[model samples]
Target: MAQERRRRPARGHRRAAAPRPPEPGPVLELEVERIAHGGVAVARHEGRVVFVADAIPGERVAAQVVDAGRERFWRAETVSVLRASPDRREHAWPEASVDRAPEQRAGGAEFGHIAMTRQRELKAEVLRDALHRMGGVETGAAVEPVDPSLAPGVDPEAGTGWRTRVRLHVAPDGTVGPYAARSHTVVPVASLPLAVAGIQAVAPLTRKLEGAAAVDLVAPAEGAAQLIVRSAGDRRSSRGEPPTIIERVGVRRFTVDRDGFWQVHVGAAATLTSAVQDLVDPDRFDPAADNQDLYGGVGLLAAAVGDRFGANVRITTVEADARATEHAGANLADWVGARAVTARVDRYLDELVAAPDAATRGLTGATVVLDPPRSGAGRAVVDRIAALRPAQVVYVACDPVALARDVGLFRAHGYELEALRAFDLFPDTHHVEAVARLAAIV
Candidate 1:
């Protein structure tokens, strides 16, 4: 039976901006300031951010723009550079990193953005701006980019595949693709450049497994990516083992499991892990210390740092969904350090003041690294963390809004923003990974 759809006009909601026809041309020239949330530059045509791909700062290039509404800004691509910036002349993607991986497989080419190295600085600046300008976190000094140490490289800001898993939506036509910018249109590609080498290493596995309802490519448990192509209604694909392939990173490679969580970009995994480690100072995990892993998705942070830090930190790997925590425990079981005690974030955090273990994780310089969902850390969690007054706090935020919100909360707790950094892990999309290190003061 075909699903019936209901049509309701916008009655109470504010109306979207008027739409315009796509500009006809090979490309039109426009001045680009900086890249927006997406990879395109934030150029103003009619006082709005005109996102332009393949364009960069200080360059005036020709672009073909398609009108988007209030939330859906204009779409544009740089066609030609009528005015050139010196940086673009010498700074190109392939030239910088020979293994340059891009969002799409047109081949890892450079956008007009001249200096990717400088892009990191800008991201750090944005953090400070958001904190000082938006969140009033500038009590002492404005937030600066995380020291170069936090950066993945000398540039310290440019990020690439350190992903362990990727969720590529299966289109109606059985075509797997990424959504174009914010648009629902699926943009197909021969292959993704930013995909961890391990994920890419197993493309042949797709040929072996057909009729898969959903293919989940995960770089699980600090090892190579394991491809678990699942089925929606069928039973066969669910039982199969992950494809046999070992993706290596850092110094070692572990056995890939069909079900596991690995950083998608193997190269950037160590950097991210180190950042998490810095957040909690996993080095401080004492055998007698008591801490909790709020979202211990696969226990990567817990196992990586907790084992070294010790079980003294009575750790609770809280996850409302029990299945995920079971896997997390299994993954971390071998570690001699603290283990995850089950707890739900919402309920547990709500009763923190009354909970006995609150003292265990209670302030006294305890560290908490809050990596929440896209929806971001809620008010209760934020308030609890603020009250606990942890000595050091590290936030691995995937979204800018939540990060901005929490920055305000942390500021209230007397935590100063020591380091703020952004990673270009996704390369082409508006999405970027941001890590903020907070230190508590008097």
Candidate 2:
């Protein structure tokens, strides 16, 4: 009986134990060195570059890699701050906090965690880096905040409530909020701190609209506030009717479309208008000076130039969007020699380059001002402007990288970057406005 029991037990002996799967790698601990463009902090870990969102400079952070599988660089968000910077503050917007999940981070202000002064410093550094790295141009001065006098009408202390325009995504269930950063997922917002008084007023009411795909709120300095609701199937409506707003630049009035291109910041329009007028110095040029405003949205710059030149300078505004061009014409109707031309900037420049009569084409010793989109004026337009031998070219740029690229193009055509004035028109974000003065190297 003992032998039989032993044999039976030995036969049933052991099943092999399962091998355990490999354990996941650890979350990295990194010292953030500085803030980079696009509202991220730069750090290095074990010789690999890391970009940490929602972290400030001089902070030690535990970051979980969100992207970068076997890549040279990694994208991460701060999981925990081992050591925090003095510049770090509790985020202004509750949705921008690090404790919030990644999907909830899509639509809040990027610099909500940074101090106001430090935010400007970081933006200045970004502007400097873009100029030096992309355009090979060394700035004599860093990006500067706009002078308070430039926007006297606006309360300088009301920086957070300066956003005159805001767009929010509408969820399927009619919840309205900002789309999470780089995601289509809606992050329901009970309050938007960055919005102006008018937008904040309408944000709550948006939930009442059915089948809404998106909602836009605009509050102009000189007009009634309006809301635009775009529903599914492209149907659009406002509270009452399609709304238009008037923007006042000096004594000039511009009727901008409710859905069209306009500066989002409340102080931006006035600051930009004053900067353009100062840089162009229309008074310094001859009365018959040929001036062009390319990518002129609603003729803001054109009107400014015309006002300074007193309707004597032949000013032509080129706009690509039909809606914007129509508004531009209306805005510039009061100026005698100012006209809006609806054409792509490149095509308009090409026509100027190929015109048979240079004198008749208004290309000789002319001065040009271009407030191009974020993509910039491009090399072809720069070349054409050079061929025309303009005395000066004033460039208003929203994207530093694009401005740097076009600056390099201008340099290739023997144009020198005379002056660059970078303004903190867009605070609490990575965006800055730059007015670049390029003079022909005569």
Candidate 3:
């Protein structure tokens, strides 16, 4: 037996509905104000700061908002140029141009649209600004290109075909290419304009590599380019033996793990090595002192010291990567006094700090060369290094703000910036490599 139900009048009947979320604002018309760190142009819309990609300073552009959740600032990508800057040129890579949807453009070459000269100028501006604002130090340091003589027949100043190492991402569906700008999604690209000819020759740009998470292309200075495909999930190389290659920097040859960390730019190692040589005063360098190369990858900079100070130079290369340390030992074997210690830099510094007076005597006039990663050596490391009371500190930095912050920290510890030189190592990107020489103030 079924209970009888009353029939209700349902024609056009409805209850109050939940309110819809507010729709996103329309495309913004922004006047790009300046170039900021992280390879983006600064702009303002209705008093809110917006970081716009694919744009240059002094340009007006209509941009599509990519992120609006932040209360203080928003993020956008230029869709159309309202007023183009004279520095803007045709992008080096067509797939990374503003003509495409922001999400579809490839990453890596953020400054491809700007003239090469202007690109260096913007990098200089960013570096100077970071130093002034964060480090509280003023400098007229200019970013210069790598010496063309070091890379014969290849014009590094051209700012293209310089990358010796190129990593491409693989999508779940087997598409292979670089990740779209500021995203993890792989956007298949037709070419890699920034990769060296060797890398370009071996790069499988059109291939769909199933089961691969990423592909690493390595073109050592002396060998044919090698391609290593990393499988999905495990992220291990598909090949055996973990390929090693020979990289020639000047007259010396270094044995580097194909997949290990090396300067991506072809001439970067030589450029940095020369810069360090020039910055390190021979009169100040002590072959018998407890000198160090922190974050020493494959003993590149350590070799620079040896080259300048002769084979008997005593220097310890501290590295966290056991493999790189092993290679460093081999690469620096000619310097009988050089040692490669496998240890984290901070931990090594802690040991040095705790050592007895007899063991720490060599540190009195030591020169410490640290090529820290983009984050810089940080406060703890800086403080520890200062505790050692080294005579000189050579810092090779990739991130301007981090370098500036660390520089400020060093200054507080009585280290004065003696010399600073910035290089356009990564020309088509916001990244600039700066070598700063800081000496203990007497």
Candidate 4:
């Protein structure tokens, strides 16, 4: 064999004089420091911070990079666990349920590294921590963790039968499901455990919506079993209904549409109503509120204060849509203190600020409530509010980022945060509903 020494494949051979560039690949040795708002594990690798999903602190693990921003930045989900932490052991025995993601099925894999409850804790902690760190609002003072009671007239513990509204995206085949986080893939749900028990009980209704572009399911306290179809391209139904249209809420008595924005959860109507009631004095309302509504759907605030609307409290229920506004008007037309006012909130707010005459559009010593879009108080609206300078303003917010920023802006504009309340309406998710009481310091 010495006569023919075989030559190697020349692998691992390097040109002696020329250097090669460093390889770009996943880094697994980063030290996780804290949790992010969206359940991502935040860690510092070398001199840069890395965000990894499904990762817990103090656990050394490998992550495959799925997204990269620029130099010294990347995000990954946990791929392999080299060492386990305390959290990894808590799920030695998990209660079997249909609420699980597909990856948790038999022989199915993905979240084997962590449990669901831990995920909830992580999401909550991140929310609390961000307020302390970024907003300078300490967790203890900014939000005292209250063992929040779910809305009255509902189930607890398991958090079942709590949803009244849901927005499910439909696939090409009309499979209705929630959009996977950061992805459009429909994570097929066998049964949504989060929806109100009534909604969960309606298996036939969901199957009927199989061909909708998207389905907006609404079940108010009373009414029919109605579903809204959202077809982007070619969604069809065996029942011969148009994809884009208003159907009904709570047993088909009341109807809503794609343009109308309702509370995401059924239980929220009660929770939000209570939040507003925490601010509205009973004296400001009247008894004949059947005709008087707070203007918005179901009049969450109105219903909460319905007993007190006798003192001529007809509020102009303002909305842009003729249909929803009409529907609301008809629903509330009987109330002596409530009237459906159709128009953009911005214009209504502007005109109100300019009211009592056109000379100075200045608002002074007024009382107002703001439930604007997620953009929060825009500069124009804020400027008008400042110019009008109300006495007391109640602000309802669903996004804490915008809430904090607006609170900071309002504080700068001489409004103090008198009282703040946060609700865990959408449990098992990072979203929160908050109310802030701001009084103009004049």
Candidate 5:
């Protein structure tokens, strides 16, 4: 064989070139313009929107792009403050920064680095922005700070020690702590500065919970503190007795499941109840005008209305959860004309809308006050409520975006957003509660 050329290795047998590692992202200096939703600060990098966590508006900071691959905008965290704002303060919870990564920081207290007053200012900016961008109605509705006088035992200067409810994660070693932002990593918490004294007192119970997945500490306004140990196998059952606690809204007392949804802020109930009553002004409406409370948890708003307008106001409260309805019925039992109906809000609205006119159905001039969940009462509910030509609709909302979207829906149905009041119920975090009053356009 003539010089048999050495056969090259078959293509299939050839070694593959090492896969290239992902390119390192860019780091740049950003001048934060304003605080955005989700506890982030708005900044621009080469004309691209960059949301920087742990940064305050009016500050220049060095940031690294954490999600550059995203198309519309980029996400970043402040690497260092190049120009600190007056609002910037030492983090209230230093231990929360156990990990260098912002997403790995302990949960809650996101605004610990900002002063309490400045935190409220930033939250107001966020609310205004949401209303303008989403609701398309930019009136001078402002976010108001809670006066310490409204809530007893609350310190005006101190933003900590207000949380009456806390959920802690359990680590493999039986230690309980908070989960890192957007992560399952648990950061051991020896102390919770944001929790009430009663919740803080039960910190030692974590070690006793071996097989528990997490623990919920609930300290209601009236009643002994209750600890609920959640297991990994079954989330429904608790290690101890079902924690039922009593909360007061004005003079009305409500018995609520400890694990259920209640305002995290200790003084939230009192403030919200007062705001709702002020806006709804049930006393102004006709006593026979039917009033409905959607998502009425333990009938707080119903109770408040009943207190103002008396039992002859013809109030009907709707709640989906069986347990909550049971508690609501019990709570409203003393009110003669106040009744609790168990039904999903959407389904109930569907029936109410399809039912004969107010005169025929005996539900005339209905005034609705709803405390819907974060997702908010959708357009269907708004349209049906509007169709009923209700004189007043009071909405209690937790998420600004949801409120803005629903505000749009209300406008589409010829309902005007007459008044909106924002509250800093959740301090040191992104959450804020808002009460909006809508009136049908005559």
Candidate 6:
């Protein structure tokens, strides 16, 4: 009978159970086997992988599990070193030393405890491994130091005081300092050894820094240091227009917003410019072709191309930031054929893909230089760039794994790696910059 039909439970009617909290665990004795990407050492416990921080490969350390919720892996930090690697040293930044409690150590100097030479060697190993495993391309590229001549009066070997940009955080209670390693908790510190002298002179580390949520210290190569304080709810905006600053790479000067993006190391700009110049052969540069720089910041790499070719060289710098595009227009004003367009790179390439035959022909023999962010140019962007069929592509990448993946995608599109060079731009850290030249298989 119809009256006998009972009401049934609706979909999602029952409340789901909450996830169980990760168990707090006893400290473990672990032997680190090798270094992995992102400033962590690989160790295994109970047949599961554990990423341990503050420990070097070939060392035994007692660590505390910070996270164990994941079924495949756990995260830990070294509490005490039972057996240290020969390459280990007193950390360059004492405040970030492993001797400190896990939650108290400063971030941004994850590799500070290792010797500089060994640090570069480890970076090289990481790069080569990524290229081989992910990109299927074998590389012997070593992470080299920025040339001493580029940064005169600075000690390159010391690997300290090279950073021209530094950011500090302010807690809700108004205490200001660098955030703790792997956390947003601000840890007050006495000194910032990685910052250049100019930044150190104006650092507001000891002050209360009231009414501000963050501070940006910028010390351009040719000018006095500038401190920008950002309020709690302001995001990146200010009262009026953000102030602009002048940055010098060799004799040429660039106008960059104080809040704009720039290479942090003093010599990074020059080193990259030189590397790009060396990678692009002058004879291959077609002045009539539509050369382009993707994610171009203030026309730095485009200027590198102009420096290698003539001022009459045809090139366009595409950037998402309007302010950076404005600066790029001014910076590249000397080049008659150079223009800066404000657009997302993928959209810009999409426009190129749909262009008329005459316009598309300009891209066929062109050279494309892309310095993508840490995420690197993903699969979609790589596919778009490949469709353009540029004669040559210069890829400047900061993350090894991302670069390797994109390189693999390019390989599938009949593009071959011609050359690759890595630079130790961010010393005492797991970060490395790589420049690769790829040519179409004709």
Top candidate, metric lDDT? 6
Highest-scoring model, TM-score:
6
Per-residue lDDT tens digits of candidate 5, residues 1-442? Answer: 0000111111121212334433446778999998877888889978989988888889998887777877779887677888989877777667554225654577787787888888887777888888888888886766676767656655545577788878787766777788766457667756788888888887653374567677768888897767766666554434465457788765678887765666778888788888887888453466677788888877878887777677777788887766677788899987788888888888888787777664365345667888887777778877778767777888988888888989988988888888888898877887888999888777
Clashes in candidate 4: how many? 29
Segments of candidate 6 deviating more than 4 angstroms: 1-24, 235-237, 358-362
Report the lDDT tens digits of candidate 3 across residue range 1-442: 0000111111221222324433345699999999999999999999999999999999999998878888999988899999999999888889999999887999998998999899999999999999999898999999998888775535454578888888787877888899888877689988988888888889898898877777878888886888977664443333475567899887899997776677878888899999999999777788988899998878999999999999889999988777788999999999999999988888989888888873457378889999887777889999989988888999988889999999999999999888999998887888899999999988
Off by over 4 Å in 4: 1-30, 56-61, 80-160, 173-176, 203-212, 227-229, 234-259, 281-298, 302-310, 330-335, 356-365
**Residue 394's C-alpha lDDT in candidate 2?**
88
lDDT of model number 1: 0.52
TM, every model:
0.69, 0.88, 0.92, 0.70, 0.89, 0.93
lDDT of 6 by residue, 77-157 (tens): 899999999999999999999999988999999999999898999999999999999899998999999888886545666
lDDT, candidate 4, equals 0.51
All candidates in order of lDDT, best leading: 6, 3, 5, 2, 1, 4
Off by over 4 Å in 1: 1-28, 46-49, 71-75, 87-115, 138-181, 184-188, 204-214, 218-260, 279-287, 334-337, 356-365, 419-431
- Looking at model 6, residue 419 earns an lDDT score of 95
Error of 5 at 186 (Å): 0.8
- Each candidate's lDDT (Cα)? 0.52, 0.73, 0.84, 0.51, 0.74, 0.85
Tens-digit per-residue lDDT, 58-171, candidate 4 = 887677565665687777655566766676632211211223332232111123344445544554565556555545555442322223353543444343355666656665
lDDT of 1 by residue, 1-442 (tens): 0000111111121212324444443345678787554345777776756777666678787776655544546666555567776655332223222122222223233331445545554444455455566566653322223334332322223334334556444444556544433334434545544455666676432242334444567655445555554544534223454333343334434332344333444444555566666555444434354455666554555554554465444555665544445556665665555565456566676676567766665655556666676556767787887776666667776666567777777777787777665665444234456777777767
Cα miss at 430, model 4 (Å)?
0.4
Error of 4 at 419 (Å): 0.3
lDDT of 2 by residue, 1-442 (tens): 0001111111111222324423334578999998787878999988998988888899999987777666787788777889989988777667767778766775658887777788878887887788888888998645566576645444343347678878777777877788776457778877777777777876754365557777768788785667766655453323464356787765667887665667777767778877887887443455466678888878888887777667665788887766677888888887777788888788888887777875455466667888876777778888888877777888988878888888988888888888888787866777778898888776
Q: In each prediction, how many residue pairs overlap at the backbone (N, C-alpha, C within less than 3 A)?
A: 30, 2, 0, 29, 0, 0
Error of 3 at 312 (Å): 2.0
